[model samples]
Target: MENFDYNLVKVFCSLFDTENLTETARILNISQPAVSQSLKKLRNIYDDDLFVRTSGNMKPTIFSRKIIDNLKKSIELIELSLNQKGYNDNLFYKKNYNIVMSDLAQSFFIPPLCLLLDEANLNIDINILQVNQLEMEVKMREGKIDFAIGNFPALKDNINLISENLFQDCFVLMIRDGHPLIKSDGDFNNYNLLSLIGVDNNITGHSEVVNKILNKLGCKNKMNIPYYSAAPDIVEKTDYGVIMPSFIAKKYNFHNTFKIFPILIKENLIEVDVIYHKLFKNEKSTLTLRDMLVNNFRNR
Candidate 1:
């Protein structure tokens, strides 16, 4: 123990969290070669290959995984001991939180969140990342992402993740104000016959639900677009219908250029959630951010 370098703990923990040499280097503000050297030293000290690079990621060995919890606890203990003499609010720290969400969620949540941060005089950076749903859980567990705000139903079943429902949102059909197929009486029964414009992205799980609805309705003539922003313009210029979140449709209906109709199916109702890894449940910064997000969007 006398010959051990304590500074290597930072590199070890960062490597374990990131599982990517480049990312670990970036987080530690060091070059990749430096990170590699530190990792080599750690491996020699431990007498084991702690991590194995496979498929472009460093997968922790069983020994490394078994010891990681204690190592993390030791680090946390050190941090707590150092900060025990001072009282610091988590929000006062200048840190960057990476969040995953759909573009529609960004439009609905970012403005209010930024406003709240500004009002509180907090020095923090919020980075919005667009990631595949399959990778979201791993990223959060690795601490690469802090939070994910959207309608991710599948994440509810993930044991390692904690999904807190903020509010329930339903789907709505959007069309131009004077859509040709609709009568003046506002009857939407014949609307199913019109071609639809569907969002293809599945990050938020919105598109999957939309696609199921389309399939159930026997709607075959549909064009799949990758973004929600493009749907509004297409609906305005053509005879296509769009199924989207009610809040988003309402936001786009502000100019009275579009008409929104509710989809009454139970599956159309989606629970918007603030999802995070269970590992961060006790973390002050994470808890503070989670509370702020829940409070900001719960009832509205």
Candidate 2:
């Protein structure tokens, strides 16, 4: 085992079939010299002339044929174990996956994502939890959380976590269709009169930026909700309006139930990302879920 790296085994298997160093290198994505070095190591380990150089090709010797079957089986097992996390018929059982999601993700991302997961025919449990930016690192380190989605300010430069930006979202003022502000010809001069509703539980940084803009505009009345999904109902009955992500506003504001208006003030675009710890950097399940999120929400 000391002399046997998986790389050496891979080179051996490729060379066994190709019999040409150039062809083996091409198949393995390595240089010809590297393949020659691996063959030299294999020769030293086996103490046999594994291949005999012929006129146009290298032919495997009788010793090579004797051990090739076992070597092939070993390589197959190694590769299967390496890719064990990939979804398959047996692994997709009643397993629970806990994810930390934001209000925006809950309203705009969860429904479509759940449907996609269900389509995979996996009886898996999904637990979507909420965690603040300051607490995300701790929870991920403890392995109490699987992954998180949203604009996490604390993880922007954190080296311990790996993140992929899915999309950019901007804040929009969502109001009921027949609100007085809509009747006022889009005039926000009286915006201070309406109570401002904001979802701030997920710590996506949108609320902070929007809060500052609301303050600058002298809109004193404010209400903070734990979930963004509740804002649509709250605004439907009352004169309250919420500043939410553009994607959420568009997805939930169906049936002309709400009107979407850009935050007249220049608001910073929030970068939505799927974040996980470095420990799961190469884990196939994490990578699979990340790819799904990118496909579902990435800017088209």
Candidate 3:
């Protein structure tokens, strides 16, 4: 361990995160050969093949997995010690942040976030990716995703991830403005009278909860679709009502094309959260962005 080069730690972590030699080089701003040489040196120093190629990914060995958490902590400690004077909030270099969310969340968060970044003159680019709930933890840990913003009940159980509740949103039904099924007084006393266009539960995360509410109300789902953005148009041109987040229903109701009605049930509310990898909790750039999101959107 005395002969180990501390500089190789950065290479090792990057390789572990990306699981590809080429990607490690790209992330570290170095040549491929340099990254390869660093990996070789790390293997030699540890007397182990820390990573093995499997199914196109550099899967870490048992030794690597055991030591990774400590290595990450050491890196954070070193950075903190070096930056005793404090980190500069002004970002001078271009950085790209990948975020995962549903279309419903995109409509609510992207516009304001983009404006804030532009107004601050920050050299940051945001890539809004689609939901891959199963791989979300691994992606965030590997730095492939910076944050996931939306209601994801499945993510709450991961100890390696941190979740910050931004706000509580309830499910609402949207129907055409002059739907015949609706009462003249605008009361939705019975959901069984109207057939619903359901959002695919697998993608939206909140659909299962909404489904439970619908079951209690004895409502019937006529059809299922994967895209939330398509619901407004579908409901506007047809009698089929769609269930969605209240914020999203309101957003699409700007033109008075649809009438929004609360699900009128206790279990209709869902929590929207900002989730990130715990490993990056103390990282300067991560902290800045997380704080920005919480401050601007929490309880709003």
Candidate 4:
């Protein structure tokens, strides 16, 4: 049995593949002096030069030949054992994860998210924080949360984060029930579109999308309000209208109130996506949560 410096194990592997120190250094991106130092350390550990220089190819010494296969096999077995244990670890079953999203995501995606988690029987503490899209990624990296689900307009091209579309929802014109303007035939022409502002300033994306859709539909006139309330709130106060996600409209019965009022546009839908860092891809609990959220929207 040869005593070995595990630090030299990778260097030996590189040498074995290349069979030349210059090539090994180039491949390993190390100086020749560093490679020589590693080789000397390994030789001392083995009590033998390990490789004999001859005809520009380093031939294995008798001592090296005797133990190389055993060394390789041992390393292989250790790696396999580590991987198998990793797959079966209890980490996934015993984690508390926090997630961030808009208020709307809670209303739409949470029920299904909970159902999936319940099935997993995981004792996870989930914190769903209300954050605007701009604050989401930083919150994830800062450990303020583990995941985020919603619109991500600020994602850069360099971002290597992972995201999946949970579901697509179209923008809809929302109004109260029995609004006189909607009573007339094609009365959509007379109604004002509402936008929630101030605390509800996040509606700008929906507002712009609605405008583009309405422009295509030839409905040039639209109004907006910026009060902070659910898309359902547009119905409680005045006849003022709002452009909102079609799913929220449908979920909250806004559709029945004023009708979909055809946007007269070609494109009517936008997707809501769930996002997380790639580093969490291997975290079983996070993956479990991700699958649950996806299935929740998928099955719906």
User: Against the true structure, whose lDDT is highest?
Assistant: 3
Best by TM-score: 3
Scored against the true structure, residue 96 in model 3 reaches a CA lDDT of: 82
Q: Write the per-residue lDDT of candidate 4 for residues 101-191, one digit (tens) a residue.
A: 6666677777867776576566678887766556666666444667777655454221646778766667666667776676456456553
- Candidate 3, 246: how far from true, in Å? 0.5
- What's model 3's overall lDDT? 0.82
Q: Which pairs clash in the backbone of model 1?
A: none
lDDT (10s digit) by residue, model 1, range 107-163: 999999988887766678889999988899999877799999998877878988999
Query: What is the TM-score of candidate 2?
Result: 0.67
Q: State how far residue 124 of model 3 sits from its true place (Å).
A: 1.5
Question: What TM-score, over all chains together, does every model reach?
Answer: 0.71, 0.67, 0.72, 0.60
Q: Who is ahead in lDDT, 1 or 3?
A: 3
**What order do you get sorting by lDDT, best first?**
3, 1, 2, 4
Each candidate structure's count of clashing pairs: 0, 0, 0, 12
Cα lDDT, model 2, residue 53: 92
Which portions of model 1 show Cα errors greater than 4 Å? 1-94
> Each candidate: what lDDT?
0.81, 0.75, 0.82, 0.61
Between prediction 2 and prediction 3, which has the larger lDDT? 3
In model 1, the Cα lDDT at residue 140 comes to 87
The whole-model C-alpha lDDT of candidate 2 against the native structure comes to 0.75
